[model samples]
Target chain A: MTTVAPETVPAAPERAERQRGQPRWWLYGAAGVAAALGIWAILAQMLAGGGGAIQRLASPLAVGEQLASYATDGMVADLRSSLAIFVAGWLGGGILAALVGLLLGRVTLLGRMFLPIIEAIRPVSSIAWVPLSIVWFGFGFSSKVFLVGLAVFLVVIVYAVDGCTRIPGELVRTSTMLGMSPMQRFRNLILPGTLSEVLIGFRVGLMAGWGTVIVAELVAADAGLGAHLMAVQRSYDIAAVMATMLCFAIAGFLMTVVFTWVERRLLPWRLEEQR
Target chain B: MTSKEAEALGKTTRPRTGSRHPLQRIGLPLVGVVLLIATWEVTVWLNDLDSIVMPRPMEVLRALGDLVVSGEFWDDVVVSLTEFGSGYVIGVFAGVVVGVLMAEFSVFRATVHPVVEALRFIVPFAWIPLVILWFGTSLLGKTLLVAYATFFVMVVSAAKAMQQVDPTLTKVGRMLGMSRWRLAFAVQLRAAAPTIASSARAAAAIAWIAVVAAEYVGASAGLGVLIINASTSLQTDVVIAGMVVIGLVGAGVSAVIGWLSRSYLSYV
Candidate 1:
């Protein structure tokens, strides 16, 4: 094996330079203004007997305290429960999506047969499946997994199918010329070629799964972030609600970033391609 | 502001389509669907799956027909459609305005960009409880929730598209003594039409999620309510029927937007 020199890839100094060239202070000023405006809007709405929504938002310090207490309190356990469900559901869905996508992508007959039903069902939001999930699996992990699985399935399949259909004609012809069997070509070329695109689908699916989970938890859930937030809202605890949403937003961002990092590490060659 | 510049700018942008056999383009998806339904029927018959748990295709169709004939179902459809439509239009408006502003302004993009990105990652349906608390199960509440869901998605897409406008077009407009406002409206906006159209399609899907979630909460009339009611009653077929309608409506909206996007491309 020969080592490929890093410099063999295109330089990325321009991207860094562009970032440096952009004015940072002005952007922050505008953002500060926007945040102030947002605060003002909430305050205005709350001050005029807005029923304390603004009053609730006014005490970010209090909310920050609440967040600290929540972090120490059952928040960790609650987050764990939700995260556990999220991981289980996402993994199950990811595996199924990848397998189905590969099969449909590789087999012409299977691709032709399943394309219509898949397309028809693809557009349906996973939230629409909540009722059916509740019916089939009851109000538990099974239902959550099913909903997550369904939502992820559609997105992944679409990307995977597109990836398969995008295989270069010349590559396929060359593989066949080398006496590669249909199965061999699928295993060696089609699947590998589509890996990057399929990974993108997985990322999209994971985020979509988060949204689906919220809906699922809304309908019937004993312990989860969604249920937790709903509890705070019902009690008119606006500060707590906002705090929970903050936690959720932060967690979601971190999760997506982690996935991106993992993708970069796994597909180091992508950097070269991008350059 | 200048017709000559517009015409020249338009000539540089063209769509490239990949090659595919016409038969495979249209025939495969159609044939695949028929075969899938056939397979579904066979599986149900062979396994004797309970209709309550997993309804046969015919049962689902029959249930759909029954619902379509009912006035209540029509009411639900109307409610869902109105919520979806109003929310989508408002979301697109807000998205486009903010996207354009952020793209055109340098400082504005930097400071708020992080916040917008953070908000985008937030689960859309998680806003439902707060919306209910604020607006109290009203039409306003649901519409707000839908708008919240789609707004970030469309804004990000639109803003990125705006940034990608050919600098040369802006240069040409400037050479012709075009004002910044005119250049933005006549050139940047038109150039970003395709991207905006794609974003709108994505926004529709996110909007659908929001509408359904809103209905699932405390909605009195909507397909979401019907599905929940059907589920409770163990009317799996009716629930499936609702799913079918939602999927079809989504596809229909996307197809229309896609056509409009193409039309806009030609116009520009």
Candidate 2:
């Protein structure tokens, strides 16, 4: 493996020289984006000009103007509520999944016993649970949270179990030989080793949670981004609907960036290998 | 202890060889299912809960049987399947075309990246309102929703797969006097096949989720419609039965995708 590293050593200087010109690449990317946006704006304007139901499609400018006004139009309350439910559910599910996964992974026999059932249940979409959730919890905050949390839990548990079970056999053997008890081994090796993988699961789970919360809100909610979307749609306010969608997209992008930053901070030793 | 000592100890303590009977492997999972059913039935019986809140396992099973025997159930199944299948096929086809173009041209990739990245964040469900507005509650609307949901996922996956194709392989093909088009098809596409296939399977699942969601919002016939109707009527058993069908269908779709990939890409 170490010998393989030297094979690419001669190309390093060439790659560095190419990297030095990356700012010019960014300029090209910016131009490309501008061109794409221009095309979209033209298309939207053309569609809007066609009249009839085609007029229902908001022009890009209209959507942008609506997005700007959303902040002052009392939509912030709905955004806050959605974020609250999303965070609460994600954290609740993640913590529970991690704990359960660790326990299950440690007890190999139990893991094996439950693995089939878990897998069978895993393929069932979170949306499938909406009816049952509604029946069980009614149309309230808890139902939405339950639906979101269940989706997150299912995803995170798999990651946690995989992280735990993938501990190197050599590490375990060495620890045992060093007279470290099971508890000590878990604290010193298992926990740290598993955190990196668990964090990855959490990252993915967070996205799943966000998506599920929106779905839950769409199905049943007093207030949230999804509800806001439906409300705007019912009124034939295409611009507001588009603006709401932009909010979701922006929020998702920001959340992913934040999660990734946190992940790097938490697992400083984990180096991402280039494919 | 030294590394050698630890290695020796690890080998000795490792679980024994896989000598269990095949039946035992199958039997355990069956036992687990049976245990779950038993627990569910017993708990329902002991609690004497209303069927509306939580139906008994037996009731749900009966409902499932009845549903399978019903003409309406089959109709809904056919309608949902048609929408899902058509939308998924169209979406995958379009996504692969766009993804290939993007991967082949850096300018195209850069132009599309920002727009796609922004739109990809919106969950498939979030598109329901807009789709319904544009296309109404017709089959076209539902199909478009499914297609829209799957399109972005497929695009991202296919683009990533194409980008990951080894440059050396392309160079090798060129050296062998292969035409550029031939090299792309034979070398690059084949290299990306596994990833593309896996992503297709994932997109299929998203398509299912999207179609069901679209139906929940508005549809004349489908499993989602059945679920919404049953839930509104407080028929928990029917709702569960519908869910079971959805899960089975989803699992079946993925299993088929997996089989196709394994057989077609046996070299991988």
Q: Among all windows of ten consecutive residues in candidate 1 chain A, which has the lowest summed lDDT?
A: A1-10
Q: What residue runs in model 2 are displaced by over 4 Å at the alpha carbon?
A: A1-22, A49-55, B1-19
Ten residues in sequence with the least summed lDDT for candidate 1 chain B? B1-10
After the best TM-score superposition of candidate 1, give how far the Cα of residue B253 lies from its true spot, in angstroms.
2.1
Model 1 CA lDDT for position B241: 96
Computed on alpha carbons, the lDDT of every model, listed in order, comes to 0.72, 0.76
Highest DockQ, which number? 1
The deviation in Å at residue B264 for candidate 2 is 2.8
**Pairs clashing in candidate 1?**
A27-B107, A27-B111, A113-B32
DockQ of each: 0.36, 0.31
Q: Which candidate comes out best when scored by lDDT?
A: 2
Q: Each prediction's interface RMSD?
A: 10.1, 10.9
DockQ of 2: 0.31
Model 2 Cα lDDT, one tens digit per residue, A189-248 = 999877776776677776678888778988885898888887888899989998998898
lDDT of 2 at B243: 90
